[model samples]
Target chain A: MTVTMEDVAREAGVSRALVSIVFRDVEGASTATRERVREVADRLGYRPDQRARQLGRRRTRLVGVTYAVHLPFHGELVEALYAAAAPTGWDVMLSPVTARRDETTAVESLLDHRCEAVVLLGPSLPSRALDLLFARVPTVVVARSVPRRTVQVVRTDDAAGARAATEHLRSLGHRRIALVDGGRAPGAAERRRGYRAAMRAGGLDDVALVPGGPTEHDGEAAGEALLATSPRPTAVLAFNDDCAMGLLNTVRGAGVRVPSDLSVVGYDDTAVAGLRAVSLTTVGQDPDALAHLAVTRAIALAEGDAASAEQVVPPHLVVRSTTAPPP
Target chain B: MTVTMEDVAREAGVSRALVSIVFRDVEGASTATRERVREVADRLGYRPDQRARQLGRRRTRLVGVTYAVHLPFHGELVEALYAAAAPTGWDVMLSPVTARRDETTAVESLLDHRCEAVVLLGPSLPSRALDLLFARVPTVVVARSVPRRTVQVVRTDDAAGARAATEHLRSLGHRRIALVDGGRAPGAAERRRGYRAAMRAGGLDDVALVPGGPTEHDGEAAGEALLATSPRPTAVLAFNDDCAMGLLNTVRGAGVRVPSDLSVVGYDDTAVAGLRAVSLTTVGQDPDALAHLAVTRAIALAEGDAASAEQVVPPHLVVRSTTAPPP
Candidate 1:
């Protein structure tokens, strides 16, 4: 049997109530009695149970976060969220969604912990579920669009970022540009729409697009397809930095020079994009501003402030060696 | 003031005990009364307090996990650990170590949730602190080595993996090889020792060593230094896949051909290594086996099993398209 507070009390020759007070580290027990009770508890190999003590508290002061493990950008945002929560006296609890674990399971774990508010990072959940969640608790959706006014939103302007990327390549005299789309991802549609609109505005009759996803392998596949085209595009815009890097490797392997032969642009300037060896030109989102807005909104809603806010941060183009005038 | 269980019970004309039974989903409350209480609670915006409910349960069946957000391999291992723990009916709580947050703050959050056992993935804590943690609760350390026998350990044989990588390059007719080290990471020392031993075994009088760390930028720096040497090495063994990829990009940019001019080898066959565009030849550690051993040992210890286990899985070389005969 496990040792309990009563067992420590009996060994230390003190009342059970005194042992409880000492173990909880709260006032009402004398210093000598506290020391004696702790010694006896230590001798009995008894650790204080945090769950029991939490029952006596009125507030948990916890904010839950659900993030995908594979997204490096999401990891950065989580780090920033910690800093954002420090000044507000709130602790952040993370529930990670991996390949094996679904978003539902992650969100359920957060609810089980009784977090006052929850922030879902790049959530793929359906709109109805998000609306229900917003009604149930103070919910903040990041990197996804939600129509409900009850939920708080924090996201990058993907369409504007994609338009900027296309216009930059067009200004460099690249008429044949292709967009390697991220199929079914949260921000894919907006990016695709932006690319199409920019191409139309540039008076390009023929628009090129290839199927891709959020991985390097997908980028490689798209690159191979681009190489096999009748007239290879002068420039390519990938869904994200990972895809862009993959395309770069594929193109370089085939003896095709970047920017000189085919200028490349990517989204989400991750750590890999900034490396001296890579130096990928990409669209960069301000994760600090996104995290700050999400945290502030969640805190306000959790603290019974009824106003829900929607925040949209613009993405900027980070030009490097990857993009140049096509030969 | 926030709505409480007592307020909900009073408004619904039901006892607080009955309302709790309904909230807990226990069979004590009648169906009609349960629906009425839930309806009244919803109208009053009263959510069930999980902390109060958790106090009545004897076991939490929660295993806390601590991992670094920057390490992609750790992310894969975490996914595998989740699969391994599914059969045991235990939930996982994640605490991430990031640039802004320290391990202490992360661990404290897990302790606050009252996790039954903790599985620290590549912990950077000192041995004395690990021993103290083991005494306080059932603990398992993955990737990092601890001197305390009370704590369970699961790690790859890093020295053997490094030796295999070196030998693979040696077998490809490359004599002059340089080592790009990880620099103070968990398995850096062992890998460095293994590379040195393999070089000496191959009877190479002059061993080339360069200063490189865990990231791609470090690899780029090492590559720059290697290029400046009078006689550049015929082969290079990077500390990890990230470093190798960086070196590959650097060498390519300098008009140096891989495998034909300088054969390259990397450690830790990460997802990026397996991509067709990269196709990095590296050492592969079985993450599934490592995660399984750690989770099983953690569960056994948490259930009061006294036998502490130390598990070391061997690493094997994955011969991809990277290594070939040197010019």
Candidate 2:
């Protein structure tokens, strides 16, 4: 049988209301009474029910995170979010989005847990769904931007990063540079726009844009497609590190040497990108900076602050063994 | 602006008790009354406070998970856990242990959030801490064993897995084999015992065990040490896949040809192990099975069932490009 607060109050010879006030830690009861009630509760193994306390109080001080378990980049962001939330005296409540669990389930679980706000990492939810969410609770979308200004966003400048990658190849005397399209992935349009702008600026009209995705298998398929194209691109910029790695492996396995035959650059310099075997050149997003800003903005908004504009962080290229002057 | 049950009751022209019964789906209200109350509540945007309902109920149906965000293996297990818990109608709450957040803090926060049970993934907590935690709330420790038989455990047979890895190397006609120790990590001791037994069984007592750890950096250091020994071993069994990848990279960087000059086998066939560039031969633990058993045990324990015995899952070795017969 579970011991209740009423049992603790009876044992302590105090009113149930006084015990409740002490448990809530609000301005109430004498110090001596508080200590006595705590002692009684401990002796009786009575715990103040977390849910009951929420009904009696106004704050939970929990910041919920909705991130994909499969994505290593999201894992890094979650760790950074914990560090960022530590200083604000708010706890992080994680509700992971897995293959079986959808975004709505993840967000609803957090809301059900009484989290003051939520942080969606690389969310794939539609704008209208996000709008419905923001209407109910404060939300911050990280690593992706939504159309509405009403939702807070902390994201990397995809266009600039894409431009930098393309220009890096162009400067290496590679005239035929290609970009593996991310399809409808968040910020894919911006990267495509950036690549086109860079190619136009370099007077390189033959832009090779092949359909790809954010995974390794997608990159492998894209690699086959690239290899089959007439006047194949000497260089390819992948949507992300996984795609880059897949493409690198496929082309290498097919007797095309990386850097010497084809140069590949990946985005989101994840941990795998730094593996000695996979030494991928890619764009690095600052997880700590983005996480810190997102947490700050989320806490402020939860405290009834006005909706703020989107905050964009700059991404830089990390050169490694995968990139060299095109053959 | 929060909507209260009082507002719903007033709008529906019913008592607060009637509204509560309707939301709780209890047997108090008539069919018409329940429908009218729900309609009024929806119009008022009155979500039943999750916390308040806990005070009025006996179960939460929440299984809290304590895992490290930095570990890919943990990420995989978390995904599996979500899949496992779905059939049981329970939701998982993740509380990741980061560099700054200790395991105790992680567990306590979940406790404060009203989680009914906890699943510790590759937990590094000492026996005493675990004992306290298990005593308070039902816990299932996955991928690791604890001291007490009273506590529920769902783990891989580490010794069996290690023995298989050693025998795999031995069958390749490699007399000189080394074991990269996991050094105090869970299952490290069992692996050591298994390797020692295998060496004795093979009558090839050239046991070369180098101190290592769970991370890739530790493997690099172990690789350096292994390379320094007189009459270097031709085959090495690494602690885990990350360790194996690191050792492979480090030795390759030092100009050692893999499989011809040295053969490597790793434990825990993580996704990285299957990469075309790093096709590591490794022992594979089935995450789905372990997760299923763990959720079953945890939910059962939380439901007032007697503590069941530890559940052991078998592990199999996956042969890839990294291992071959001795040169």
Candidate 3:
């Protein structure tokens, strides 16, 4: 029950092509024709579609971002991305991936908004799926690595981060260090490999790699698994901050004192880990630097520059109250 | 030098109106004209704008939600909203408010996307600004109360929630209960009033109101102030979970055990509050029910149903490891 462009064209007695030009604000129509079309369109109650009007014009200068709503780290990165994009004359459009919204749906919304480029924050999608996105739009994947050499990437060296966490616990006189692995979670394999390599380098070949996920509940379950293991580890390096927090909490609740009984180190020094109550020793990813690089690459690609290279940001270990010399 | 629709029309030897029809997939253009326009558009690489094509004649069926990216509770509510919108044949579009993006910009982006209605999650904007938006679009404000009778609001009874938290502390046999007030934050005044009312009803009219903000650092500072008081309250209610966690950590570090020596309670039972280590007893705002109500009202308003009414959902207290009978 809505008025179409055809209706306006017929009423105005002009070609539909002329009306399209007037609405698009392009150079095809004369000023008189433009005014006439506008009058007729207004008379017909044509609700102007911004996207239609802006099409074939200059750039929208919009950068789309897809992030998981539940991840606190993603929240921090999104804040950093906004700061990064502003001075560069670009606006950020967020399409959050919630429980009911998938990455494809979220990404498509951004494209629908006419965003020139997209920055995907640690997406857990398959390589084939990413190839499709890269083919369609200029994409920069953050916090996760992609296999395709042609895809641009801005991410942390997950293996190095896990190594730093493992080495920190080892330096604190912790001998039996166990890794709470992230299983198939993004960067999990790299983290697991990093932990194993660090332990082997420390001359502790026997590794205790317990399966964990990206949630606090997973961390709690992993903590129980650790408690049940015959030779309890003196220290544990968790997949991420949430898991580390859960593990730390469960062990404490079971009468095991942190730093005295178990030295726990978490990845991604999220805001929660720094709380006085948690004070989790964790690895920190540089959100600002990573975001800056991502936007830089995205803007370059959007402006018709080639960007098939990857930029790796280093992670730093933050020693907090949760980690100390193993008893 | 992006290919415009004018170029496609000229290349296809068709009127611009006919080209627009072909691209929009709407009636009025013949099969031959549509095929010719499609062939020309593909050859010219005229990137079709989705939003432009989905205009008029029918609904975009999009419900836009504005939420603060930094809030964990907001994250939960957004997930709930997505689930609520999916069943009603409506898609959810997210515009996250970060440090760089304000509420105005967020809402405007939604409008630009041609969303039928907008749902703002606890906006701290002035009433006058909201009136401007209300005049332009169908808006529903969630988790925040507006004084305007005509504004549609779906929110928790914050005063009742605060009162429930205070009453729970009093029932646990704590006499000197201090209220850590969220100074100038959204719903702070109502919460303060509720706390005061509960205190006055119990004949504990000499209220210990501590100035606090919504962060963990604020709670730590409030905890220091509480420790310095001559007769420190046996129980304290914080502005939020983050503040309560900070206060708990600081007090415990100062050799004051929780619940045994002092009791602590918080508002907004975020994910972190439920952790066994930070088992914060806090008030729960039902995101599922609130999201359902907000979407239902938004769809109604979008469908021409007038809604100047406010719906207040009740909040329940979640008793966790943080609260116990005061010694």
Model number with the top TM-score: 2
Q: CA lDDT of each candidate?
A: 0.85, 0.87, 0.85
- Pitting candidate 1 against candidate 2, the one with the higher DockQ is 1
In order of the candidates, what TM-score does chain B achieve? 0.82, 0.89, 0.83
Least accurate stretch of 10 residues (summed lDDT) in model 2 chain B?
B49-58
lDDT of 3 at B269: 92
**Runs in model 1 with CA error above 4 Å?**
A1-54, A147-150, A307-309, B1-54, B147-150, B307-309
Candidate 2 wrongly placed segments (more than 4 Å)? A1-49, A227-232, A255-262, A275-279, B1-47, B148-150, B223-232, B252-261, B275-279
Looking at every candidate separately, what fraction of the true A–B Cα contacts under 8 Å does it contain?
0.72, 0.58, 0.62
- Over the stretch A1-327, how does candidate 3's per-residue lDDT look in tens digits? 446678889999998787887876779888888899899888887755555445544567788999999999999899899889879967787888987889988887787667889999988788788888888788989988877546688998899999988888888888899999898887788898889999999988769989899999889989989999978999999999989878876886687888899999998999878877668889999999999999999999999897767899999989999888988
2 versus 3: better TM-score goes to: 2
Fnat, model 1, is: 0.72
lDDT per residue for candidate 2 within B1-327, as digits (tens), equals: 678889999999999999988987779899999999998888887877676666666677889999989888998899899999988878787889888889998998788667889999989999788888888899999988887555789999998899998999999999999999998898898889889999999998999999998988778888888889979999999999989877886787687888889999999998878876567899999999999999998899999899878889999999998888888
Which numbered prediction scores highest in DockQ against the true structure? 1
TM-score of chain A of each: 0.83, 0.87, 0.83
Residue A95, model 2: Cα distance from true site in angstroms: 1.1
